[model samples]
Target: MQIYNEFELIARLTHGLTTRPDVALGVGDDCALLDIGSDSQLLATCDSQVEGVHFTLRTSTPEQIGRKALAVNLSDIAAMGGVPRFALISLVIPPRFSQEALEGIYRGLRQEAERHQVAIVGGNIAGAGQGKQLMLDITLLGTVRRGQAITRGGAQIGDVLCVTGSLGDSAAGLFTLLHPDGTGAENALTFVQARHRTPVPRVAEGRVLSAFGPAVVTAMLDISDGLSGDLQHLCERSGVGARVFAEHLPLTEEMQAIAARVGKDPLDWALHGGEDYELLFTLRPEKAREVIEAVQAQTGTRITRIGEIIPSGMCLIAPSGTEQPLQVRSWDHLH
Candidate 1:
């Protein structure tokens, strides 16, 4: 058998899978959309965090791990322009796992759930036979008004591409963890590490964008697989291309300082680093300013127009006025 990357494996597994008519959208977008005889469409998404694969107790506390495990799924709901309402958490516990740590993890989960106003209605716990690592699998359910879910398939040519918050902070935070000897300003290190541990899902911003409707917002997704890789997803689904202005990518001074201290390119992290949990979206060129202003005023999230939808070919325009193919060098779980 040949090994496949994460996306290739997903494409292979989801090919020709049977789905019901109630499935409003399926298999490609951030969340599965379903119409269960309600005025609102349901958004469903699930994500899992495996010990050693997604996180380690050595780096992240049990609370942080639990919070992040849920936060990632919340981001998927946000990407779909839905309001998260409920969650089901499944746990795979290894032998000798600390009970106190589990309680701490639940505390974090509760904190995040309260913040998002999502109810944890039910879940399952299972023993991991012969497994040494703990894992949390979460299924999140959300809703959006009928005909209002923002998906990746609705972008149009000349639409403005936008992203919420600064990119690369999570990546920089991970760098500090992996290479602790790399020194930077204390505040910068603290900020980036917090970003890595507990990412803020753009739920409020997503709601604001969804309120604008897909006609104006065009398309949206959360950046989990880096800007370039996730942008590829958006383009493929929308059957459009994009041109990203390298100079326009939002980067924080903290991430830049950390990158400099670690002797890495901040641009690389901003473009290709994964797990930012920020919203990546497109809007009609004419309505871009209005949407940006609305989101900022309503949610206090800065939305930056870093690119535009093009007829074909994804490209990156450098600050020096040079254009080149935008490469996807994002994290691949199965690679």
Candidate 2:
């Protein structure tokens, strides 16, 4: 049997992935060089998805796992209003895993890469020996016009906090997958499952939000850490507080149904269920409506005004017209 070395594996894995014009050097190089032009700023981010921790092979296919691993990183770039240009992937292949399965994973990665016009520049691959798990780590490079990249620190005190798309579906989907019987309807199960497995990064929406005048989108970040927790991040960075109205939260009917069957609060899922990958942005109070309408008309993404930045700290306004300090009970890797 001929043993494949790391170089050969890298060649096979990155085959056919094309780089953008800005990329001076792609694969087969010691380091990837990018020519992000004087008018553009470079954006870089890295993310990892691990077996048993992020997903289980029993519940998710290799392709789904591969797409999500890259999607999460893409969400990071999108949060900055940047265009993803290149990627460096690292794979920890476990024993008994076939080359076909590995290739399928790359195919999944390629699908998202192509959709976003990103390329696989380079990466490292290694075997995990035995009794180990598969892991994928991706570092993505992106570019945005100078002075247009958004951050989490520009929100004003009265800026309205808005979110793209519905929330908690990913978390509810996870629950549905774990507790299948809890999903009374097969359609509900499928919807949530797809949401959990193949989350769409809001790249176009982020770019649109950032394209508006500086006063339009004051602050922004992706909601990978859940709405409640990620909102606090924006608040901390901008040195302001916020109040998220429970009534205004956008929850899908599917999320509601799954929550009811599982005896879980759908609101809680929306608040702290993390990994939604939706954009959480703060907008100028006066022009909020115009920007929202423009985004809806252009991209068809549902934007909801969920809260507003305040003087200090975070709170949640209940449906009964009372306010309580919003807890920071988001996803923590260390527990």
Candidate 3:
């Protein structure tokens, strides 16, 4: 039997699942949107981090692991333009895991929850049995105005493509961790590693974008799977295509320095390095300047206009004014 990739398997499994009218949006978005009896809609999303796969003690402390586990889920809620309310944490504990480390993880989780004003309502704990890795599965609940949730399917042709914050820092950080030669500048190494360990969820930015409403904002999703791959997701959902300007991509000085030291193309990392946890969104071409200025002023996060939505076919416009196919080389857990 042929095994499917992460997305192909998701489509195959979720096909024709039963749903009700209350399910405003399901199965194909950053969060599951449901209309409860209120002026707001409920937003739910779940994500997990596994030892060795998502993190390692050698690279990240237990607290960092716990924080990142929740941070990833928070990013999902942010993508939907919602206010996170509660979280339920489930843990798969490997045998003999140190109590001190576990407490540190919980401390980190509490710190993040307090930062976002989200309560840790409840959860379940289970043994890993024969498994040797620790895992954390978190279900986050948030709420948005009755009709204000943003989605990836709302982008239209001629919409401006924008991204929040700089890109490729997390990937560059992971590179430094995996291939540490102790030769890079101390500040650069620290900056990238911190980005990889605990990324800031764009909750404030999402709220500001949502206030603009869908007609103006159009579409959004967090860049957990790389810019090119997630842009492909947005294009597919919106039934349109995109043209990304390679020269316009935002790269941080630290990331560029690390890439230079390693003799790797920073552009490749900007395009395909996953786990930046930044918001990639589309907006009306005419409203681009307004939205960009508002988000910057309100949230203090830099927003870059990298391209525009097209009628069909994804392409990259190079610095030399050459056009080429924009390929998706993002991370895939199931690969």
lDDT of 2 at 228: 79
Q: For model 3, how does the per-residue alpha-carbon lDDT over 236-309 read when each residue is reduced to its tens digit?
A: 99999999999999999999999999998999999999999999999999999999999999989999999999
In candidate 1, stretches whose alpha carbon ends up further than 4 angstroms from where it belongs are none
Return whichever of 2 and 3 wins on lDDT: 3
Residue-level error in angstroms, candidate 2, position 307:
0.7
Better by TM-score, candidate 3 or 2 = 3
Q: Which ten residues in a row have the lowest lDDT in candidate 3?
A: 175-184
Cα lDDT of model 2 by residue, 53-143, tens digit:
8988777887888889999998988888878889999999898788887887898899989999999999999888885788899999888
- For 1-335, candidate 1 gives per-residue lDDT tens digits of 89998888999999999988888899989999999798899999999899998998888998998899899999999998899999999999999799999998899899899999999999999999999998899999999988889999999999999999999999999989988885698899999999999999999999999998999999999999899999999999999999999999999999999888878999999999999999999999888888999999998888899999999989999999999999999988887
The local distance difference test score of model 1 is 0.93
Order candidates by lDDT, high to low: 3, 1, 2
Computed on alpha carbons, the lDDT of every model, listed in order, comes to 0.93, 0.85, 0.94
Superposed Cα deviation of residue 149, candidate 2 (Å): 0.6
What TM-score would you give candidate 3 relative to the actual structure?
0.99
Most accurate candidate by lDDT: 3
**Residue 244, model 3, lDDT:** 94
Candidate 1 TM-score over all chains jointly:
0.99
CA lDDT of 179 in candidate 3? Answer: 96
In candidate 3, position 38 carries an lDDT of: 99
